[model samples]
Target: MAYTLHNLPAKLEASKMATLGYARVSTQDQHLTGQLEALKAAGAETIYREKISGARADRPQLAKLMAALQPGDTVIVTKLDRLGRSTRELLDLIQRIGDARASFRSLGDPLWDTSSSQGRLLSTLLAAIAEFERDLIRERTGDGRKRAMADGIKFGRKPKLSDFQRAEAIKRRAAGETLGAIAKSYAVDISTISRLRA
Candidate 1:
């Protein structure tokens, strides 16, 4: 079903429910000025700013904003990526917000507002599509791996120790040699010798 901002119900009251905004730039070279201005114009009372990699989920400013949210509050982001790096992460954050009896919206994507019933439905549909996409990618990856294996293409890291070295290490261990001594003789870490047992 199609949903638009205009057709949607009246926006939540900012007085009763705070409309907080989040602005993030993936690198220190980027600036948050534009996002801040847009968010302020969109009626965001308070804003959280962060300059960090989006791939990192442990954003300090985002953590503080999430913790500060209360029931009836709405979180606003200049873009969806400002909230999360990927669709799965976005959905996870939205789920947490919903659980807190709060809502989320992105100025970049008007269709993604959790403040209304239609928006909530859209959110569910988007999340399902994201999950389906991930599953398809995983299936294709597995198929590719199987095909490569059939073609005699090896996968995974090359063995750190040769077969002869491995066999010698086993013999040394059986001969009551210390693990550190075996590792030193082979010029490899102790973990490498331990893995030979498997």
Candidate 2:
């Protein structure tokens, strides 16, 4: 069924299952007319459009479309890249639609549609590949971290006090100076001085 922006809410309220569309453009200069027309031609009753990078996870319109999903609803996009840049992110979005008892379809990439058996099989394979990619990234990151640590590279926040200042703070504490006094002298927190072992 064809729907315009004016009657979209009324149509949505009347139908239990709706064909929802999402169209995205990475930059303000990009045109959404093509995607919008394609989605409308594909029988999308309500189209959500956003001008934002697919790499960003905090897309407001996409979030709204996801929230508006109902059981047996179908979410259609012109292309897979229009939905997300990364395979993991696309799979995750599709999984969320499935969790909501809805399905996804890509007009440009027919094999990515989740409403068919072939598409489901391809999604399963893609999910496996995404998992493998994540594992490789984790392994590489862990190895790099280990190498950096072995080379004396420190991670996390820098120490607030230098070694000399720390030693002096401990000595001052042992000599009966108040933590507040030591902390004020070093321009550090009182908790920092209190944690120093004498």
Candidate 3:
């Protein structure tokens, strides 16, 4: 089914929902005319446009659109990809919209319309799959880290001082040299010299 404004749920129609539009281009040189026209024709009362990469987490216009959403509001995008860079990102954005008591629609992707029953079901399924994929990746990363640790692979930042330098620092500390003086000699922090053990 074509999830157009006319076909929106009766509850939404009765509430006099606002149709907000978002249009984005990846770069400054890219044009937003096509997207703007489509959104206008689709009955978008307010349109938000941005010239920024979808991969970026910070989108000022998108942020404003999200903040402007009200209960029963519908956010329309020219395409799903224009809204998010990946499926996970798209799902997260939709979930946020749902949390705001609003809905989302993509003029280019009918299955993404949350106003329809079928679209809601598909979106829920996709969200579950994305969550499962994230869990699997986390599990794999943990397992790999454990294996590397078992092989004596060290993690985190390397020790700042060499073994000889560490011993010398400890000796100097034991000999009543000030931590600041020892640190100055080695060009290391006073905390590093203070942390040295005999």
Candidate 4:
């Protein structure tokens, strides 16, 4: 569907003056004041604030607000990213709002809301672009890693003991030294000594 906020139901009719605002901050130290201020500027009322990671799909307050929203209510957020940074999540939420016959608007990103036809279309396109960007990043990373591995680029920490040290361990073991003694002498794990010997 050509997503546009105008095509979506305006939960609050033009007659309704109040807009419900939702603000989220992923960290406790981060304040929601800025978001609230922006929402208020956008003519929102009764702003609900939560300090929780948008990465978390289940947010109690946000869910409750969505559920409690009436047809005449418009949900306002400070930014599209505030609602959700993930494309899948944003799209799913907008779809849910449609089912609930509610409206949505964002103050930050232009591709923010689904309360207007243009906004909805922009939102959908933005979400798809985000998803595409993520996929491309993953693909590039995988290819780069593969190329690196092929170039004999080693990863992780180097072994504590050198070849000479390892050879000495084998000689000591052959000379009847216990694995524990050998491990303790070399300051290495018992499993490491055992594996080296094996």
Candidate 5:
């Protein structure tokens, strides 16, 4: 059954409810000025800002912000990606907020708000799209690797020592030459020379 705003939980008053904003940047070099301003304009009473990669699971400020949420409070972000780097994480966060009786909103994606029935529907649709995108990327990458393998193309770093160089090194070592001498002569690391024996 489709959820309606009227059938669900009572609508909380905007004045009585607190809107907590979260702003994130991928690197320390990036600035959070624009997001901060937007959050402030959106009436965020308390803002949590971070300059850490979204791919990283450890976000101290985000943790603290979520912990501080109370029933009827709303969590707001400038964009969906600011909340999570992956679709799974995004869905998990939304679920967590909902379980806490708090709402979630994204200023960039207006439909992402969980304050109404329509917004909730849009969030589900968006999550499906994100999953579809990730699947497409994985398929394309696998196909590309298979194609490259068929073309006799190498994937990783080139060997530092050629096969012929390795044979010569082994022969020289058998003749009582030191591993360091062989490594120095071949312009490679001692570990490279040692690895040839194994």
Candidate 6:
């Protein structure tokens, strides 16, 4: 390669162009293929697909798509729910896209695009409502957990060992044996054995 400013014209980097498509499904039986087909019909240059719970936040594929977005580009999804299980997260993602100088379009909902005045207004209003709902859920969940704790209702998974099993485990531990060996015999964790001894 030779730097020739005399005869050859100076080359400039091309402007960024991007249109990403996102598809999601709630179950194994719910095929994402239909969403993909619809996205393609909507003229998406790239596609991202995933199978996860709507309530899950750690979607690696969605993160990748967001990272790859460019200014003047768009993020297209079959629907708003496909973008997120949480209302606030969905609103945050759309806001981020706007901050990135990009846009969002939904195949199902006509209010996503900011082209029309009504569409733009609806987008902002809906995003606000979603954010409010998410906050309310968080507050309610915290309050409910606190109430349950006061009422002596334990949250999360229950202990697998009964009081009788715990007594037997204590006896086994007192008889001289490795916790691992005891656990192997009973098919339980060493921590479980330690708790029993305690």
Per-residue alpha-carbon lDDT of model 2 for 1-198, expressed as tens digits? 123454646665667688899999999999999999999899887898988988787898898899989999999999999887887788898999989989999999978788898888998998998889889999999999999999999999999998998888888888899988889988888998888875
Q: What C-alpha lDDT does candidate 5 achieve relative to the native structure?
A: 0.85
Q: lDDT for every model?
A: 0.84, 0.87, 0.88, 0.77, 0.85, 0.78
> Which model scores highest in TM-score?
3
Candidates in order, TM-scores: namely 0.70, 0.84, 0.87, 0.56, 0.62, 0.58
Candidates ranked, most accurate by TM-score first: 3, 2, 1, 5, 6, 4
Write the residue-wise lDDT of candidate 6 on 1-198 in tens digits.
111112322242125456778888877778887888898888776688887777777877788888877788888898989996766678788888888888888889987785467766887898878778879999999999999999999988987787887787788889888889878877888887887754
Whichever of 3 and 4 has more TM-score, that candidate is 3
Clashing pairs in 2: none
TM-score of 3: 0.87
User: What range of 10 consecutive residues in model 3 has the weakest lDDT sum?
Assistant: 1-10
lDDT of 4 by residue, 12-128 (tens): 444564477888899999987787778777876566778989888778888877776767577888777887677678777777776777878877765666777988788678778
Q: Which of 1 and 6 is the better model by TM-score? A: 1
- Which is the winner by TM-score between candidate 2 and candidate 5? 2
Tens-digit lDDT string for candidate 5 (1-198)? 111112223454333677889999999899998988898888886788889999898999899888878899999999999998877899989989988899999999988889999988877887788789889999999999999999999899999998899899999988989999999998999999988862
Off-target runs (Cα >4 Å) in candidate 1 are 1-16, 26-31, 165-185, 189-198
The runs of at least 3 residues in candidate 3 whose Cα sits more than 4 Å from the true structure, single-residue gaps closed, are 1-15
- For candidate 3, lDDT tens digit of each residue in 1-110? 11233465768555787898999999999998899889989888778898899989999889888987889999999999999899998999999999999999999988
Would you give me the overall lDDT of model 1?
A: 0.84
Which candidate comes out best when scored by lDDT?
A: 3
Better of 2 and 6 by TM-score: 2
For candidate 1, list the clashing residue pairs, or say none. Answer: none
Judge candidate 4 against the unseen true structure and give its global Cα lDDT, from 0 to 1. 0.77
